[model samples]
Target chain A: MNRRQSKVLRTLARLVIRLWQMRRVLLLVVPYLFLFGWLFAAGSRMDVRPGELYGVTDEPAWGSPDADHWFGTTVNGADLFELSRLAMATSVSVAVVSVSFGIALALLVTMLFVFDPGEKRFELPNVVGQSGFLLPSFVVLLVLTGGSGGSLGVAILGLILVIAFHLCPVLTTWFQEGEDGFDIVAGYALGLSRREIVMNRILPKILRRLVGVFATYVPVVVLVEMALSFLGFTGDRLSCGAMIAYGQGLIIEAPWMAIYPGLMATAVVLVLSLLGWRVSSAMRTGPLPRLF
Target chain B: MARIVLQRLLVSVIRFAAAGLALIVLIELAFCVIGGSDRHVWRAESYGPVPPGLSARPVSWAGLLEDRVRVSLPVLFICVPGILLIGYSWGILGARLRRFHGARLLAAPFSLFACVPGFWFVVLVAIYSYFHWKRPGFADDLIVEQGPDLLTWWHAAVVALPALAAGAASQIRAVSSVLEREVTRPYLRGLFMAGYSEEDIFYRHAFRRALPALFAAGDRTFSALAGSIVCLEYAFRYPGIGSLLVEAVRLGSYGGILVSAFVLAAFVSAGVIFCESASRLIKPEAAGG
Candidate 1:
């Protein structure tokens, strides 16, 4: 083969080898993907009415798992399986939005800090920002969203903002460490502007590290969102946490109602966590150390 | 020595002042944004109960601060002992358990336990206890109602166990890694060849080297505990700073939220400083390393 074809073949081989190495994680994640797909496809076909299943006077309460109600029925007469699907969808959506917003804001703030290192001298903001995470996130959400009376969209936005704010200090610390290790003197010698060096050289070099950090943090955001939803702070949203909370009272009579949702939530977190662990481990074996 | 202590104290005081100011500014900013008003008005209003025209901001601030301080005392009482108990026991137990077969078998579930949310455990226990209390011929003495009281040590222990398990899992991993690294060092082989007993080498020499990492793990575990304390306190409906902050937030009480934030920050800072100091006392050379 010619040189270009040979190089392309080599790259494709490397990709295949890498994918083979990640087969275990991929296998672990397949069930979640299948569940998500099934939920998506079956969601529209399933009746959306809660009263049709359980709210009626004659309807059985705390039904066991069966063909009619696969996951069982909640004490409040809601279908556990359907509620779990909805909750999982809502939670995954919130987690995606929150993590995305957090990472984006972290990148922006990290870039800002890189351009102006003057803020480093004032450690107060870092401390204060960290305290945001230390404080109960539900409180922050409640305060920001004005006692959770807002729409689901607004609640999600509030969660995104708070999570992003909490993650800023952590991301900034990682990014700062990366910048510190960069050859800034050499960049200057190369006659690159500050923005050019940061955008092109520093950022590109640290992109994998940022991804590792982002993966490590996604599980945290998911847990935080779950906690907030469990506390009824997410404002009437159907979340795994809310499902678990609602099922807590009937845990003895109908344990499936709680266990299924808990397992689903745990599955999501475990998958994201393993993905993070894989990414971080790969980065560790690669050129960079694990940022998180 | 006295000068060093004085300097450290001074630095801590300054740090606390800065943190307090930063917390106030953050609260003011939050209030302004949420209330959709001018920053200056929020700033003045946050100083508290001053009727907007009073020159004595300090007095009102101090009075408000005292109330918050009072509110935070119980949180400190509950969280301090709870964290210390969980951190020390779990850290030491986890490290020691890494050697045992039975404990090794638990490694997977313990690691998975770290992934589970603390509130889920709390709810499950609550439900279990409720059923147990309702059991026929169950003793009245066994039916202890878990509440948000300061004396509810058992309640704290139960609620804190999941966080503790999570912390212990990470601690076990950290300790094992450190031990693995230590085992591969040349000095370990040298000690083995020098006629030192295996237990002596592992427990005396290697353990000393592992202490710093173990302490660092403990620090991380404490921080995790602090994070989980918020959820635990809230889930158990504990009257700690966490639940108070939640209540304040729900009521849109800016001053209460600010005060709780400040207290929580101070508590964390103090815990970190204390951990550093203890670590230094244990291994002075490993303070910053």
Candidate 2:
């Protein structure tokens, strides 16, 4: 088929698959949405005025539960429910950005490792980039958070870089595995250039692994971001981890402060893990042939 | 045959124990130099004057060991047994056991982290024991005092080391199982039936077959540990090399940064050594003279 025709067919196939998967995920999401909505509507209104946190202790806004604040009021008296929503959105964005960058970097690096194993010059640069893996993200985040910008983009970029660095090995391995089929060897034997072979052939197989990897890493992304935010490295106003750390001191007066956010974060992670498993299962042609 | 099997088992245990002990000592020494003092012994002794012998020792090895035993024993005794029981139960339940190749590999380290919940359980027991043993009217408050810097770093190392060791042990088991599966494939079976067995089959045939991929797996495991360790250390406030590195970051302490970098580099080097050693065992011919 011509390039245009192939692209159209690919788009159609992807749309069908996405819609089918979305239906399942949406089924799972509906109950969560209902729970969140009911809780927010039924919960007390928060006074999370701009530049104000909940309680007197500079804790997060979800620090107390009462008739005035069902989820409880933070030390600053901000509604716990609303702040939970914001934390949820921030976490979802972090998960998306981190997983996207991680998968992309993994694909690129793995392709480099697979088709061009001994070409040291290019791979050397890749290794140097990977040396950043050992540098704790907190250090970089501290340096960055110390700077002026606290934009959402900066936080996303930070989270993505951390997740991507962690993902390098997995991406590389999956790429190597998917690239090792008879077709790839045949392509090389037939004198297809490395770029042509990787782009036209290896990538298709690698793409199959993307759903699985993306599903797997999303939960980890959420956890790492929570950690980063907890460490005060996120630079944003609030994060799931930051909320947990900040709210712990008020665990007694406002148990909901910890309970609500912690439950949200945990649920999101569990969902991502289950989704990852589903994606892996869905991609199965059969029992996977072992690769040596 | 039984005697030979027993000998190999003894050798492997000795080797594993030696590596584990060497790791503990080396990490403690590194924490000592970083913490910059050595007054405490057995626990953080903030109120006391320094003993002359401890001050004069090569690396505060005894103080470090006491701290390690004090902190680590409770945590490990609780976590190791608990996880073994849970993992054992899961193993029994069959389907509930993680079967995904990647998930299984990830879980070894993840479960090690997950076992931190066991620390709280340990602390409760310790508190109960203290009361049971006739409390000397100790402070039972949750907010434990942070005392002198003397060997706080060592104490952190001692606290962190067991978890790291456990994490490494699980990863090795997971990766080796994956490697074994990879090496014992049908194609490898073909090479085996072609008049190879045992050493020849593993080294000459299987090892050659799996080298690139094994390195690939090593890279992945190493990277995953890198991300997880920092969070784990920070959560426990374990003043390991990673935690020191993080504090250096938070305070922008350049000395802490250097130490952290040096220690992290050492770990990466150790990982490389681990890979090389594993390769040698799997395929001796690969390191052919």
Candidate 3:
């Protein structure tokens, strides 16, 4: 065999060993992958127009679980399985958008604080970070949206605002702490502009920590969405929270209606939380300093 | 030393007040925006409807003060104790559970439990109530009724257990990591050689060092509880500030929303401030650093 071929084989063998080491984490990913795949397929097949019933049929309401309808039907004749899949898709999108916006806002706030520590204008963001941690996201959403009966766009916008504001404080703290640990004085001595230092040197160094923070906050955002949906604050939206709420009445008569959605929500949350924990642990460099 | 501590306490109080004022203004502005009011007044009644024959009256500070206090009291009563209990229990359990070998495995279910949304608990309770309704027995009495009272407080506590457990488990993981690092320090080895029992070394030296971290974890747990309580209150349909806020939002009661938001923000800030002060008192040296 040629020497290049032997080098390629050795690299492949090392990759296999690494995969074996991560088998436990991979095991956790399997169910999430299966669920997401199913959700994608179901979401593609169904025409989901927000605030309009799509899956209603002539099938008996609260029907027992059978081959035709895998998770039975809601009292309104909406397919339980299809509703759950749609809910999952909506939840995933909401979480991604909110967390992304939250991270960007946090980074901006952190940069402002780091660069202009003396300015009184920055104090508002600091107070927000502190106070935001204390108030629940849903309370903020409800207050901002003025309760349910709004359009889907408004509801999603409200979710984004609440989640983003709620998370900004934690992320600001994380980034500020990370910046403190960096050698910014040395960067200045090397003739780097403040913006350049913050954007290129400091942010890249803390990128892993940023990912860790995102992981930690995603589960929180998901839970907040579910809670809001459960409260009927998401404006006629079908979410895991809504599905669970709808299924609660039929637990005994049609247990699958509640159980399937409950299990789906539970599974999604569990997987995300576990993944968050793993990512944070793996990326953590040393003992985490106290945020306060 | 006493003067220094007192000065620190004063600074914290001032900071909290400033933040509280800012939050009130923000909530007021939000109310104004939602109500389409150009008035700069903080009173809810500023944006409230007036009779056609009557002009918009000037803001009444006394009536506003009374209304704010009345709206805030019940929510505080139910939420304060519930949050404190959850934080205290989780902190204590986290500190104590660090020694077990199987703690990682044990924490898995708890972490999952923590991820269960607040409404899921509400749904579970509803389902339980349904089955209980059919049988008509003992469980029916403990379920929360329509209002926020001691009964609702108890129900909130019961529903909060899973989330609390999750918080405690995560805290345990964090505390244990810190403890593990402390154990590896050379001072611990010296103590082991100096005729001190392992338990004595742990309790007297190690646990003391771990207290600061544990207290920090407690702060995080308390913050989390603050968020979860809103959902719990909503699910139970309890007449707490959270539910009141939702109703106000639905009806577009700018005054109610403003009052509720201000009260909730103030309470959360106070809770955090209290936790910080308590943590400092628990470990004076750590606080100094």
Best by lDDT: 3
Q: In candidate 2, what are the lDDT values of residues B51-95, reduced to their tens digit?
A: 332223433434533442344334334433443444323322221
Error of 1 at A165 (Å): 4.9
Residue range A202-286, candidate 1, lDDT tens digits:
6775675666666666676778778776766666556777667666645566667667778777876776777666565555335
Clash count list over all predictions: 0, 15, 1
Q: Find the candidate with the highest DockQ and give its number.
A: 3
For model 2, the stretches where C-alpha displacement exceeds 4 angstroms are: A1-51, A57-70, A76-78, A105-122, A129-152, A166-179, A188-195, A252-255, A284-292, B1-184, B187-229, B232-243, B281-289
- Identify the superior model by lDDT, candidate 2 or candidate 3: 3
Candidate 2: deviation at residue A11, Å? Answer: 22
The true-versus-predicted C-alpha distance at residue A125 of model 3, in Å, is 5.0
Give the DockQ (2 decimals) of all models.
0.24, 0.12, 0.34
lDDT values, one for every candidate: 0.59, 0.50, 0.60
Which of the two, 1 or 3, has more DockQ? 3
Estimate how well candidate 2 is docked, as a DockQ score.
0.12
Which numbered prediction scores highest in TM-score against the true structure?
3
lDDT tens string, model 1, B124-225? 666666667663211112434585443345565655577666656665555555565565678879988999987777667777766655554454444455
How big an interface RMSD has model 3?
Answer: 3.6
